[model samples]
Target chain A: MTERQDCASLLVQHLGWIERVAASLSRRNGLSGDEAEDFASWAKAKLVEDDYAVLRKFRGESALTTYLTVVLTMLYRDYRVAQWGRWRPSAAAKRRGPAAVRLETLVYRDGYRWRQAADLMHSRGETDLSEDELGKLLADLPAGSRGRPRQVGEAAMAAITDGADAEAGVHAAEAEQERQALGTALARAMQGLNDEDRAILRMRFWQGYSVADVARAMRLDQKPLYRRIDRLLSRLRTELEKAGISRERVRVLTDEDAA
Target chain B: MKGRIDDAERLAALLEGRVTDGERAALLAELARSDDGLEILGDAAAVTRELEEEDRAAGVLPIRAPRPGARPRLSARTGALLAAGIAGLLLAPLAWRAGRIPQGSYAMNLSRRVAVAGKGLPPGVGSAPRTSVRGADDGLSPGARAVRLGARQVDLHLARIAGDAAAAGAASRDAARLLHAVAGAGTAAAVYERAAAPAGEAVADRDLEAADANAERLAGTAAVRLGAWCEAARFAATRRDAAFFRDTRREVAELAATRGLPSGAGPALGDLRTVLDGGGPVDWAGLRTRLDVLLGAAGG
Candidate 1:
């Protein structure tokens, strides 16, 4: 095959991971998968366009995996900061300065650190921990944690671009199991949403309305439902993404559009 | 080119405030050529998103937090408009065509115009202040052309309950002016530093609709817990405040639990419990050591 075809084949081979990462990023950032892809593509283009020869000087200074993770993370952080720098910490969170960043922020900043926080609290003998367990551990951390951690997870390391999925597939089953556990916890947290928000969620995810359709059905006008969905999903996705569910992995309810 | 820096600064100021359609047309017409101008627009857009995100995260919602310790955000209508504009700009390079600007750059462009246009206006006749009985003012005219054009562009839904196009347009000007006054770098910032600041005081006193009021209130209450708890943590740093700090932490943690939040809030809240339990140092300096251990413990 020609070089172009080879490249196309490689991209196709890894499309699943791209969607996964795209979804995960979207859920983490209160953005859509499409939005996430815009940044992901930007990263890929930068990768292709930049001369990697610059790294030639640092040959053996650190593991290439560590170095690459840093670069990808830095790029992601730049995009995130650029997109939403004005966000202050949550009232509860802000008061805890140098305290742990939000779970989503923690995931973006230090991928597995929040998870570690969760584990720490669990080990401390807290019993009957519920969905809010994630919150407990981070809060328990010492004040002055200052800023999001930059350390990422195995899943994050695997999904920056096209074809990283196959390599990651070897571990997808394990990751999915983790996501399942988090998903259950997330579902439990759903109880807190107000009725209107719950209704909107039901319409979109359960009733299978297009975002536009949901807007129309609500009769009020505009995409209130979509924004609510995005925000609500961002909260849930924070835990789920950290666990392993890629936003791109959404299960389609039907194949009507395919026909 | 003699006025490049001045013009750029002016344009940046305009972008920072709200731009009327007329102001937008004028600004877009002026800066379409320079690469620097485009960069300014892009940077402003990025800054605005960051600002809004920060706003939302800070609990600037229209909803009340049913439970305390929630973050409120922009109303759904406002959110949709802003989100749509953002999504459009990101997806479509077509939005910014040759010599014509994309309309979505509202925060940067519109906010700036409102500020500049209102700069020296008298109090009652402030820039775009209510077109109260703009009776025929809504009609399209070459003179009122810019305003008319913007009126049409304002999505009817979000503004319908708000007021007519003219009224909403007027409010936009006021809101923009206020926002730019605070966000702007010049004298504008100093003047509106406290006045017209967006932060709300009480959840019930907020302008949120019925659906959102509860969630917003919860978040507001939580904000208090967060602030108090955090302050309690900080003040305990010096010589002997262990019991005081522990009691305060417990208060914070229990508050979180009652709201159905994860319960490391107090008494046994978080890694503090671990540190204290293990007989490790419990001072402020020891906080980091305990936090690090928690951060490192992911069941691996």
Candidate 2:
């Protein structure tokens, strides 16, 4: 074969690798099947457009496959940032707070179950996620709590059918208000803590660091560290209670960090 | 500006596990002081996660292994029949050479039966079946084709073993075995070219399977031949039996040359020279283990 023909054959072989990289990028960016195919085709066209200049310039510093992977990854990341640039999360998701996009990506795109995704997120330093908190983020409310309204409706039909609609609306409204108030109180109390204290809280709760790790990192004796942690929780409880958060709500919030 | 760029590079290095202890301490100190430090760490972490995610998505997955108890796609009964057929073909040459079977009857009956059965035709007179017979003068009977292919397989196995032995400096026994197998292969190749020369239709599965068995037997035969040659070479070298070495070398070289073998007298000649000059290191146990592995893979 002539040099051109040999180069063409080499390019043909790399087409499969390029397509695979493009497909991965598409999947990462949550593109549909057709979009993924289009992305792959585009990547192939770009590689070959100027007489395979990109391939010709390959210096053999790394394996051709590895070089292509890094190139494709950078291209894909650039494309995604140019297109989306943190515009993915809606106001509601933003209100749901930090790592919401990551949570969704893990649960939906990566196909991780909620708890596993939550653990991964925490490990990656999004440390505020308690297991129950993560579950709530995924709308995996406690079975009885989420299902209680339906049970109440069934009982209302058996006894107070006429007043059922009004009673149910009032109860749901009250519950929503309480939930919102609890979220606000927690957020405010968390923000009120100094940066060092917040970091300690994260290390202790979010990251699931052992008490020993926390003490070592904080340069405190284990006994003093434990006492300091206890005092911090007590202060949070008082602050939340002042803002009308019930003791039960505070207990629920603190329960996740008991480990 | 330089300090921020340094910090960014340090953070990237930290994520990639290239950060030094002092840099790690500095990065940790920065992280503890402010939210901006935390944001830098989070972004670095996110980039690391993305790279990992891409790798998982794009990495070549391992080929699923063949399950245990996986036999050839051909049934066990079919394999057994093939083995039997190959055994008959292979034995014909040896038996005839030994004067155990009448050559005339063996050739006429076995050839006619193999041809007819192989073509899936009745033994009735038909000119059309004659056209299906590939090599009239030197063409292989169906049985001969099986034997020939099996012999070729044996030759290949011997070559591989010989190569391995040479590599491991166990060249003496392996070289002799290889020379024997090469000669055998030349004969087998000639038999196959004359007897089996690509008849228009695909060779039947039974014939192919029989050939596989024949190849294994041929390899075994080659191994036996190697042992005999090793003994002969050792005797010739140790006793200064120049006449024996001269004769054996000529025979091996002549057969190899006729077969268009690249290493005409190379290995056998080299092994003889080694033994005669001053014996070289021969890892006999290692060579045996290697042969066992090869034979085991070949279903010997």
Best by lDDT: 2
In candidate 1 chain A, what residue range of length 10 has the lowest lDDT sum?
A250-259
Q: Model 2 misses residue A44 by how many Å?
A: 1.7
TM-score of chain A of 1: 0.27
- Candidate 2 Cα misplacement greater than 4 A, ranges: A1-7, A87-259, B1-181, B184-300
Per-model DockQ: 0.01, 0.03
In the order shown, the chain A TM-scores of the predictions are 0.27, 0.36
Q: Write the per-residue lDDT of candidate 1 for residues A124-167, one digit (tens) a residue.
A: 43224543766664554333333434465789778776775766
Over the stretch A1-259, how does candidate 2's per-residue lDDT look in tens digits?
Answer: 3434434655665565566657655644445456567667666776676776665554332234434554554455445445444323222232333455456655654457788888887776654878787777667222211111222356546775556588899999998999898878877887887655665666565444445545433333556677778888888899999998888888877874553
lDDT (C-alpha) at residue A30 in model 1: 35
> CA lDDT of B217 in candidate 2?
43
Instruction: Give model 2's docking category.
Output: incorrect
